[model samples]
Target: MNQNNKVKHPKGLTFLFLSEMWERFGYYLMIGIFTLYLKDVKAGFAMTEAEAADLYGTFIALVFLTPFLGGLIADRYFGYTKSIIIGGLMMGVGYCMMAIHSLPILYLSMTLVIIGNGFFKPNISTLLGNIYSTPEYEDKKDEGYNIFYMGINVGAFICNFFGAALYILLGWGYAFLAAGIGMFLGVGIFLYGMKHYRAFDVKKGMQQGDMSFLKIVMVILFPAVIAGVIGWVVPTQVLGHALIGSPSTDAFIFACIPVIYFYGSLLAKADKSEKRPIAALLTIFAVVILFWAVFKQNGSALNTWADRYTDRHVENPMAAKIFSGLSLSQQLTMAKDSVPLYDEAFRLQKADGKVLQEYNYPTYFKNVAPEKRLAEGTQIEVWATNISQSINPGWVILLTPLIVAFFTWLRKRNQEPTTATKIAFGLLISALSVLVMIGAVYSGGNGAEKVSVFWLMASYGVITIGELFLSPMGLSLVSKLSPVRITSLMMGGWFLATSIGNKLSGVLATLWDTYENKANFFWINFFLLLFSALVAFMLLKWLNGIMREKGIK
Candidate 1:
């Protein structure tokens, strides 16, 4: 247990991994309940699904967008450890403020998290890469990132239970408060381990031929601010609020224009040596956007499916009791009679005595069949829908070791696929996960029946493999390929791709209400993924060539 002489990965790596794990646990916990909390009529915001998805998309997109600046600032002025601590605190406080429920306060809180993440997320990851850059651990960089990535999923996996319990036990506000607490704990852990990584947190201090910080602020940050203002102030409802999209969404998309331009400007201004690295990074970033677009739907549209369509009732006594007690159970039943519910299709209708969409307290039971339905007078205390969000992370925790070992074996044989190839294959395999949803559609006959939870589980299982393949490798690739001076900034670029894709996923999910045939929804996801995979496959040869030329392979 000697700290400095740790075998394989560095001690700093483990500390950072655990820090990120807890931070992500809190972040994902907040996200897992976010839209659901918004849409919950009782003890929730009572927003429609579409409204909630739009806001969720916008929030996540902006959360990622800020890292572009954060990374740059860290590389130039602020040290990595400092940035991470500040960012973590900001996010922790934001989560706590979400408990307030005031619109202005909620917005202020979200802004804090977004800005805080910009500082914390990219810098810690860059610091990890910096630690691995040492000659001793250099060979195991990819493995380091893979192991680090498992921490993220570990947090994501465990947060749902906490979120469900806090929300069910107390209320949505308390659940949100829990997220803040988790974030603070993460910060505390990271600070405790600061000595482990403090040596590597040195600032690069504006590398040779790099863009001057002030110039970037003028050209990029200022423009982004102006664009956001225009988007926000322009009367979307010129006469009434008739903008094509919501103000928040339009503002975010507009803000991205300047930020996107800034990244493009990097390519234009780069020296010959830097150009290839930047070009390579951009190509990979563009291709992976699709993977994120589909994968991130777990929050919006897919959550709705698990909440409404998937039959989550556990018949097994042990499992059912566990889930029910954990506040993660879902109850499903069949409503033979036409039930009055508040949906977009019948929003204006007033049939039931209760004005708000009133039906069976347990919404899942409404669409299920009699045979499968719980006996009358028998109340099934089932798990919460948000709990399903944990499945992918659960799989990641289970499968990462096996996947890592498989790759390690491949490395020994001098036969490991390059990171680019792994990412390409990940995209292809992720496309397959969508088909499972398509199957769920057919099996359930366009929502005329209740689909088995197995379909949801199976779809998640397939996607989790793809996720393990792509996500960890994507981090490894950026770390490996990026020039030392701009390492964290490139990571920001990677997150930028994710930001755009996250928004697109939200856009795609929001369209769920528009699709009459459920299969069409999944097909769209499939095609989007297929197209992304094809693009990645097309770039594989060139990317591999770069990897080999750089002596990274």
Candidate 2:
């Protein structure tokens, strides 16, 4: 092997990077406003917090879940480029359709996104790995992935501002339409670089003894649909208060049963040489589910905290003016007007007499002292709640270079941690980030007052370090550990873990009002991550031994 000071990676990386960035721009833009859209009394479904969180969780989970089937189709029949193109178009149309404002149309739009993501997500990732498979690029694989991951965060970081501006200026429909436009741009970029990735777009086709596509539909798809219907229709009384909180929850879990079994069958059928690596990957996947269950709350639980509990008012006149000009600041008028009185769970508080509607009921000054209240009819400028979603990606952009450098330094000294060790440590670090939220809960007097925005920023900063450690490593791990024949399939398996944990995050968030002491909620998240970390730590030596056996570091 020749070592070169200046390694030239495939030119295709640039195209993939841009395409994925735009795709994520569209996706994150929509997600940044999803719950907000669902909960808006004037323009949205007017759902309660729990209702919105449940639906958000289910939607995102399905978005990730489809990639499993998408990867299979891409690997066997469609090839990466075709699958990606089709998926992008579907998603673009879906985002545009979300502007329709009908409940049935909303569901239809979500379904398109879910299906499109299945075709788009895993295939693009697998295509990148294929480009890096040659001996010349093998050593740079991790670095390539890190660069690619940064592109994702870049898109995620900038999208919220655009979303906020569009929502404020033109309304929700225009904001969603912007998401569609972003997807179309991404598709266009992908097509421009078609020539570069064409060689790597070779389909795996069917292997000897492999299940046929038709068989998969019959055995996996049909069973999953039937199971979902059964779960949805079964009476709660018969099952003892809904197996997992709602009909969709039960249905999704039931549908996943066959999928989980399918992965198990993969392990059962693998050759002896492949068993240990597959088992190791599966074990890691299971442990990481808890990590995502906690981490993914950035969208739901944390978003709620940012909206209702954090002090978002811009005290500085210049900053306020600038943000307001950009349509990134929300103005609340201090005048008597009709407003819904919401309970702890954000449900409309019902009353018999008059149904009193206080102006700006969940007012910014609700927890402020009398001296702090603005004069009547005054319009106070506050930061938009959804802008808080940018913090994590902002942290990612700032920290990725440093993390890469630190790991590179360790590699130079021959002291770099194994991927499993890195992941275990990531979980532990993320667990500690929850402690910051715990502090915020206490400092805010258990949600009786608004806390400083720095607390949220600090927590995101801490968790981002953990994210840089785990997320990219998981992608690289799958590339390194999976058998060549089933690489994309295993990537789908990784995403399945993510999908399950994402749904669990929503479930946990739905229980937000159940805890009177808000600190207990953060505590629950902390313990869950801590438990996962401990399990990962306990298995570290064993996992590392397997990695050594398979010649992966």
Candidates in order, TM-scores: namely 0.88, 0.91
| Candidate 2 Cα deviation (angstroms), residue 410 | 1.5
lDDT string for model 2 (175-197, tens) is 89999999999999999999989
| C-alpha RMSD by candidate, in order | 3.9, 3.3
Instruction: Give the Å error, residue 193, model 1.
Output: 3.5
**lDDT string, candidate 1, 423-533, tens digits:** 999999999999999999999888867788789889998998999889878987998988876675687789889998998888787788789898999999999999999
For each candidate, what is the lDDT?
Answer: 0.83, 0.85
